[model samples]
Target: MPTQGWSELGGRLRAMREAAGVSLNAMAAKTHYSKPYLSQLERGIRAAGSDHVTAYSRALNVAADALSGPSQDPLRVAHEWLVADTPVALHREAGRRVGESLVDELERRVIELRLLDDTIGGGDLIPLVRRELADTAEVVKCGSYTEPVGRRLRIVVGELAQLVGWVASDAGNYLEAERTYLDGVSAAQEAGDSALAGQLLSSLAYQMSDVGNPADAALLAKSAVAGARTASPVVRTLLLERVAWANARSRDREATRRALDAVDDAYEERSPGIAEPHWVYWMSRDEIDVMAGRCLIEMGDPVSAAPLLTAAIDGYDADHAREVALYQTWLAESYARAGELDAARGVIERARSAAADVNSVRLIRRVEAIRRLVS
Candidate 1:
């Protein structure tokens, strides 16, 4: 049989390494593969076997599958694919096609994992999703592509950064989340995607609010709204709502009212031509009602907040245990603030039950806080 296209494989691997920003010397040192051997492999003078593939994959923080072969015997497939005598362009195109397909599948999986986390709660599942995201990032970074391919790679990178930020946020690693969100913002800007940048800024603002920096959060939210001016109406409305929440946190009643009014205006004027980002798909009117109620509660207007919170809790899907728990906790607190002791107790019980279902420490803490408020 003809020797496989080792030269093409070698070139692709070299390109991948460069795209990943890993120096050959650095990879060699990390993998203990020796600089000369790595050079031979990259030049197509020597085929990289499974061992070498694994070592290099580990060094580059990528999935071994990219270097190895097909899922069944990826290392063998990789070696064969590299040395095939067809045009280098053809091989490169094949790799690009494969990478795009994988990226799309990985994106769907990531979204599914996120939805599951909301339903089943966030523990081991988060790390698993992070690992998968990292793998997808590696694939995008490694695969050869034209200019359009590079754009897709940048998009994937930005999305991976966002997912990393959310995972860190769920883990209570707020500082790490902030760093990841910053990375995402840079990637989005580099991709020349203002809508993605706006979403990243909104997420960053939420992270800031989580850390109790309402002023900074409000500023960021406002910046997001301004940046997303040309974005879809739904996106603009979402950003405005976030700004309103931040204003509520900062006790800027007039600003909060203005932001809320903007949200209403945007919603009323929403056109079928406008499209929301996938991440904001769950943000419906009921969710907005919950958000507004929470703002009211923070503003010490429990009488005005109670009904909205109750409506949100009632509207929330029971399958989303963690969110249900959070909404229930908010409801309980609202009832307590309104001095409805009996109703507060019942809501607290539901909150505790939902908290148990999710096993979320944060939700448990909220439940405790609600109980204290009622007591």
Candidate 2:
């Protein structure tokens, strides 16, 4: 196998293990490998033979053939065959698979954006992604695939559009972002994908709130909530939380209370049957608490905000080091608001250390804002 091929496979395996919530020890026990050995395999420090691949596939409950197949080799004959195939039938099938892979790539990129938050620097990747997305959209618009495949393609397009919107918004090009998001909403509607529409609307609302248009944000958030009723329970919970977020930004006491109530209602209704989209995976209870805390701080209730913000900063995923830092900055601001200068200074030091690990303009801007508040 090419080195890059092994590296990509290792990365995918690691991602799968993380997504399934399997600890390294648990994976080792299931695969009958030593913990250190498994770690090496995941890090691509050791080449995995077919037997090891099979064992891992079994442990991960995925197809052994798929995991250990010749396709795993980027320079393998099968890859060449796919690349060189020119027959219409073969070309179509290959294109479909490539499109699917691109969708997965897009999803991964979105996760990176969320975790790193603007720390990656520059907007260079955005246009490349948008071009790929436009290609996918064209394939779907052709409507040559069967209904099931076409539906999947449309969903991918919607997701791509949402990502485009996010990148545009981050780059401070709100008009383009709005157009992209609106396009996504329309595509979702065409595919009867109400959940995706709600997600796009919620993202747009978040952008609006960040740019100081709380009233418009709240309106968009309400529309998201209305559309979310047709989504799965987990989606509804996230959308409701977003509604709370918008209301909190608007500083509308009654609206905020009602939005929080709605969040509770949705959370209470959540069940195992409710399938969550990949984008909403990080919206945990801790994140919701942070949103509430931010809202309270904006409403001039520092007494109520401090503890919640503290918990939020503490509960943030450590692997998302940049986000943890951003939350810490917010926590410091909350402490300063409550006249706890020593505590605020301590948190600021932590934030500064974390910021060093990730060079994000957005995080830097947030730190500047907190400094202005405390000083």
Candidate 3:
């Protein structure tokens, strides 16, 4: 059933695709939508729904809300407005006390955005995340609150900055990511949270390693570890792994090995009753093994890397398509480096299949690089 605005939405979609110089067939391939189905939608014979809008957003590199014009669903309308430039009423009202409840809502929204990042590309999430960060920061700057609530709000700002930074990095906006991370570090410092500040620095370090600044990355990673000495063991373990990666990128095998050993040692210090940070939930044995394998691959020990990558990939949830594709590419690369050409071809094919529908630019670029290496 086509909505009244379907024709207008269809026109915008067609115009956007043309302006981007993307052919209809190319759009179909990128979106995984049938050519006829897309044509029908573009012709206004079919309605543009949420799934369709998301698909188009990823393929066209636009925000999902931009394509979902004048949505009828109340929830969709609310979300669209959330990501829009509409001013917050609380911020407009002078002398409004910022309460714990509002801070709690902001925290909840930040967590939801983080979870959203796991499944969607940074391209699709950038607008929503940027809006959330801006709104939160404005609230902190404009609204009145006690010192305690102020500290919590700043912490939320730090969390949002971390997310926005990571999302920017994923979208290949290195400079934006760097600036956002530094802002987050400042927020964490204001909140007197060394651990969160360290996390921000380590994230920037990871980005540096990815973008060919391994030596700088090594310094930043070590600094992150030093600054967060009082953080939980798991958090320290995660930071140590970043150190290993930076060293591996630098081709300092001895330094890389030492940092990996430290990772294991820190993880061993975990106690049963100590409260774990919510952000460290994804730091686990499997993640550690995957990082170790990736470091080994970086250090030119493909034979050693293969088994670890295989095991981690085997245990990984397939629903996390971007991660699965990323791991598969590394596994494929390891096989190729080991001269297991047949295995490399097979794994790369699987990687390609897994990444076909995942919208992460990083994963797509990785899969292409592995494809080139294997071929």
Candidate 4:
């Protein structure tokens, strides 16, 4: 114990325990370790017994080595969690009658969290949303539930995973987002939920399109359309919109125009009052218009994009701090394209103000883009 400096290990243990929402007194009670000992252990002054390592791990609800080991790589931990097999007993025990009400509650929570993502940028919400994804996955993994309930829970998990992935993308965790999206896609397919899988694929395409992988974006977007071929009119239209944007990102003007026309036609067929997928509840004429404007701006047709971007900004809700900032940047770009430098400056300033309210990685990048334009 003296050979190892306890500071780092102690810090890790303390942080993990705190992150797990366990207090010293509660941990002491659960681990049957004294509170003073626990406190000193965290301060790197006291050496814990070998038995205490397992006890602490249990009390903290983590792997024993997470506390006992000197160098536990977080990525390794995540990989292990992802690829490790669930215990046979746990899987079988899950058949004991998971309630429908639990599934309903999780579904409601997913909807609320999606709204949170819309209102608040991912920078401030990634960790929280990741925790939500973990909790839902935990329920599916450990809860005793009937087959029907299990299926419903799996579907909810897929949706949450996709949402988490999107939040990660918004927060600039591109690799993490991709991994989360793949996990969600697998869960959705396992549950026979094509629509959710398609939405997630589209999200991946959207991320790729913005992050400078237009070729990959185009492929994924097309796959999303294919996957959701039987989805509602609104859903297909939204996927097609992504396809348009992807093509635009790649500077394929003709393909972009074709996809855009398809989007418009599908939009016209969308019935206003029918039940649509909850994942796309926020989509509307306004959202479509913004995407259209973004595609035009990317395709060097800012003249056509300017009015549409302005209209979206005018109608965008205040709670969407990041998108409001981002959209304004797009409008500013459009103005600059037409030699309206003064108008561009005015719009960029307003965008700067909105950007102050958001904590998004994407918003910051756009802010920089606007700055470069004016400079």
Question: Which candidate should be chosen as best, given TM-score against the real structure?
Answer: 3
Give the whole-model CA lDDT for all candidates, comma-separated: 0.68, 0.67, 0.81, 0.77
Q: Lowest-scoring 10 consecutive residues by lDDT in candidate 1?
A: 70-79
Candidate 4 ranges beyond 4 A from true positions: 1-97
Residue-by-residue lDDT tens digits, candidate 3, 244-270: 999999999999999999999999887
TM-score of each: 0.70, 0.69, 0.76, 0.73
lDDT, candidate 1, 209-287, per-residue tens: 7576999999999999888778777777788888998898889988888888888887776642344455654656787
RMSD to the hidden true structure, all candidates: 18.1, 9.5, 14.3, 16.9
Report the C-alpha lDDT of model 4 over 1-375, residue by residue, as the tens digit.
Answer: 111234455676788888998899998889766777778768754433334455677777788656656433332333343454433234445654557766765676566567566656777777766876887788777777788888888898899888899889888999999999989988888888888889889888988998868988999999999987788878888889989999999999999999999998888776523335667756678888998998898888889999998888887655466788889898999989988889999988888888877778888888888878987
Cα TM-score of candidate 4: 0.73
Candidate 2: pairs in clash: 119-360
lDDT of 2 by residue, 1-375 (tens): 112344455666777778778999998889767788767667865444434555677787887545543332212322343344322234356654334444444344333333233233224335544664676677676535566666666776787788778766655677888889999998888888989999999989987887759899999988987876777766887887777778878888788878877776776676433445656645556776777777777777877987887877775535455568777887888888889988888888788777665545556677777877776
Order by TM-score, highest first: 3, 4, 1, 2
- Candidate 3 minimal-lDDT segment of 10 residues: 69-78
- By lDDT, the candidates rank as 3, 4, 1, 2
Highest lDDT among the candidates is held by which one? 3
| Lowest lDDT 10-residue stretch of candidate 2 | 70-79
> How many clashes (backbone atoms < 3 Å, residues ≥3 apart in a chain or on different chains) does model 4 have?
4
